[model samples]
Target: MKEISDSTIVDVHARRIFDGCARPSLEVVVTTKSARVCAAPSYSDPRSSGKYEIRHFPNGGVQGSIDLINSIIRERLIGMKADSQEEIDGLFLDIDGTEGFENIGGNTAEATSMAVAKAAAASLGLPLYEYASLNREIGVPHQMPNIIGGGATMGDEGWKGRTPDIQDHIILAVGCQSTYEEMLCVSDVFHRTGILLQEADPNFTGGRDEEYCWLPGLDDVTCLDVLKQACDEVADARGVAFRLGLDVGAADLWDEEKGVYVYLKEGIVRTPDEHATYLASLIDHYNLFYIEDSFFEDHVELYVEQMQQYGNRVLVSGDDLLAGNLQRLEKMAGRCAINAAVIKLNMAGTVTRTRKFVEMCKKNGFSTIGSCRTYDSPDDTMADLIVAWGCNAYKCGSPAGGEHAAKYNRYIRIDKKLGEIPTFATFPGVKP
Candidate 1:
């Protein structure tokens, strides 16, 4: 066996790059004795509510992150084994020496950590997913593509009018047996939905959000209805099952001081109990496969109630609620507050931390959704992460845009390389 020490790091470089959303982001390159690799960290919209996210721009600009990585981070990482992921990551934490990466910045840590992992894999002459899998089975996860946009993703600058109160109206290719099939399923519905949008409003000018999801001037229910129609058409045409999912992102709609969920565009206000009831109604009416963050992060009781009612059938998931923090997942483990979670590597700050979060989810029997950020990087390492972590499903937004397509295309390549197609993951007690 080749010694991991043979791939010792020699040099490190960092630079500022524009993310998918045109925001400043950090990318890092690590040169090892045996190989060289680079990676960029994905970023969530700063507007999106998350309680545990590390400080993204620690030095006020992306340039500060670049400087820190090139100087202190590089100095520390030199001569360290690229395959010593845990030790190197520990060094990163110790160097920062603050909770939530308050000093070094999570983006800097994430970019550096991923670059090291890739370097290790390259040095070993193994595929990234195979190396990261840690001797576990590499499975192909189903795709969760956003088909409609709302909330923070939608803005008043372009389209005819405001979008629904929900943040992301997504679709799951639950019935597809292969990642390639899932891509086809998602893309079919996405294009059909666009056609339907154009028909619904003659003024619909192909407006979209950062993720390339359609921005139609429709209410939440109407968006769901349109999505359902498109999915139904594709299901009938392809003879496969497709399911609807939602990211209510209730944090944005939550009026904390007033103690109510406000829907400015829909012109409605819902109390906590009322909002729970409304969500239940949608679950029944639409038969949704997943519902994420229907209640705000602090509303553990509401999430518990939702889990109790539909946890077995629906993936009552947490994004803002859990915030990809292991501690938060632990608090909700036995409480049954959530049965699923969204795993964004940036939210966790390091590759080791993200793997720990995924492990905890498995221990609690919670499905994981490897998700992309609103402001994502072109790096397709997330696709490899999905396979390595054995995520049940993954979100790469719509399958159209370059950033999104990069992930899907990479996953498809991995799926093809695997000798046999992996079994598709589905919600408990749900057919699709």
Candidate 2:
């Protein structure tokens, strides 16, 4: 092996496109001094993969990452010693295995993976995830993100199935998804059929369409009506039972002063401290599964208090609270800060780091959800990861688009594939 020096070659680039599928996707390549190290990854939303692609870089995250690598490629090394990649990889231990990637620096999984991966890429000549997962069979794992919108028709409980590998969920809007009128319809159907419908996810987190749709005020007339209409239509169409949700991620109900919950930009202002009581009421009145970041990140303790008071009925969740950072999640979970957390992959560059966050969440008795990002859809790897994490409750829809359907479809396959799910739906250990 050799150490970094001015003379070490850093040339060569190769790439391939792994077709997309019902879930997430990936396009990538690898490089070496002057040869092809490996092939591209395989997984995509085959139809919509055109929406996303990976290349050897005319310029992008991958390319920019390489630039960063080049900058750090020097110094610390004292010789023109041409080193083998395995040897270069061995150097990671000397540096605490944490370098490059400031996006979310909390755990060892991400940073270590990043460092070793770069060496492997330098060795095998492949991109990150692709290279890291090289040669490993990439199977079509299941992905489900069922957003329970139509409250009464869907029911208070959405799903409580035997999880395959992973099963996490997101119960969309409470005002619309958990309206009393809708819950009764769902409950009646569940009672009549003697089916559990879907069990309310203790990890239920909330979301909104603010970033995707136009909702000026969460409590406004038009917004409230729109929310109800959205749920009403789903209940009529899907004819399935669902659960109530709290999607603070939508930030529509965001008021820095008043804190009363708003679905859209409902014009209610509240301090972080002001909102907890109202949120507590939202849970008590609706039997809500969860309220995510009822206030902003600064209000972590307030939300923690909400969980402290009523965690039994509803789990207070966090998305922005940790931003999918393993280290931050470590601190929060260690402190028993909140009841649940959301796992968003893109917040960190690669999947390795994300998994660490999931694992930590499990250790802390923290609940988790498989989430969708603001990016393009049809990438089912996320769905696979979700199922792998054993998170049943999902959030993969906003009334339209293949991205949502793609993951939802994956969930359908999971149930179909597993034959029958086991009981005891908890993260952690062996089969119950």
Candidate 3:
């Protein structure tokens, strides 16, 4: 039997692979004395990458990231203890020397960091989640799947220059007895929404966006209406309750020079105050369970106001506003800006750092939702990460393709492995 104490990293390998978008991306393999493990980081479109996020690639493309990992990174890590995650991650920060990790790509460093963690866990004969959790108790995570997409993710495909202003419309199976039941509830709503869209629209292309979410080409409000109808039907059928959520992705709509949010597809623009009012209307009308990034990243005051007005009943969360950075989170938390946040592993660039971000959110009494990027890898580490950390929810987008399904399928496996169903996680003052 191998022990983590005796295991050391023997080799590090980095290579280029295609992400779900068929775009070049980074993958890393770590060989320890006891086990070999691999991992890849999620990728995002350069346009949508958070302002505080580390660069995904340098000038040399994916190969540039690969070279740095194979050369200097590998040299520094060759003989290090595989279990020393914090120390190893610290080395990555020191080597990069940039707050944004411009030297070694974030994707490269994140993948390498995850691979090492997995290798260490295997060396100790433990599952990655069990290893990372450090024996802390965790519960089954509720799934947050995007049922519809618009805005940047929708692009101009079949829309003829018209698409919803929001990026994602999602449904949460609020009260499920088990992870399997939650999966069934969400899946039913997702498929039912698609069928209803087809029947209601003559121009329905049966098209889906990059994340495999249906692109109905309807306006944001209409899309929400369709989603609510689908959720209502599913609830009636299964005797389940569902909650709605949105990734407004307002940063994409922010027109910096104009000092307003430009809804290009809708041909309307709104000042910061107007935008917030518009969002509030949606929340009230839909009784939204969650709303993410309702303002541009820099508009912290608006976030505070929104949270104050709706935080009790809704998850007024941040994604672009938080970007999974501790400093950003601190600033927001100091202002009591949000009630929930979206945590992505690559956003912080290491397993240790990502875990720290989640912990910090917990410390501030904020809900954490582990998320997947638009251009994600097929890697299922997020399943283990969210479970290990006990996040309130997991969002991987509709489970329409392999990349998305990988995480959901892994969650089911983990549930079966534990042989017990965890109670659903809920927002404050909300019951499942």
- What are the Cα lDDT values of the candidates? 0.85, 0.40, 0.85
Per model, state how many residue pairs clash: 0, 61, 0
Model 3 steric clash pairs: none
- Give TM per candidate: 0.96, 0.54, 0.96
Model 3's C-alpha root-mean-square deviation from the true structure amounts to 1.9
Model 3 C-alpha lDDT per residue in residues 186-247, reported as the tens digit of each score: 99999999998887666897888888999875778888889999999999999999989899
* Residue-level lDDT for 424 in candidate 3: 52
Worst 10 residues of 3 by lDDT: 423-432
Model 3 TM-score on a 0 to 1 scale? 0.96
Query: lDDT of model 1 at residue 15?
Result: 83
Q: What is the C-alpha RMSD of each candidate to the true structure, in Å?
A: 1.8, 12.8, 1.9
Scored against the true structure, residue 313 in model 3 reaches a CA lDDT of 81
Write one digit per residue (lDDT tens) for candidate 2, span 1-432.
233442243432222222222322233222323332322222212211111121211134333433333344323222322233333333422333433233212111122223333444455443332443334432222122222232111111221111100111233322222222233443233232211111222222332221122212122222223333444555565564334455543233344455544322233445555556655665665555656655556555676677678666566677667766666677777666677777765444345556667778777776676666443345444555565555534455342345554655555454444444322134222110
Candidate 1 residue spans exceeding 4 A from truth: 155-161, 426-431
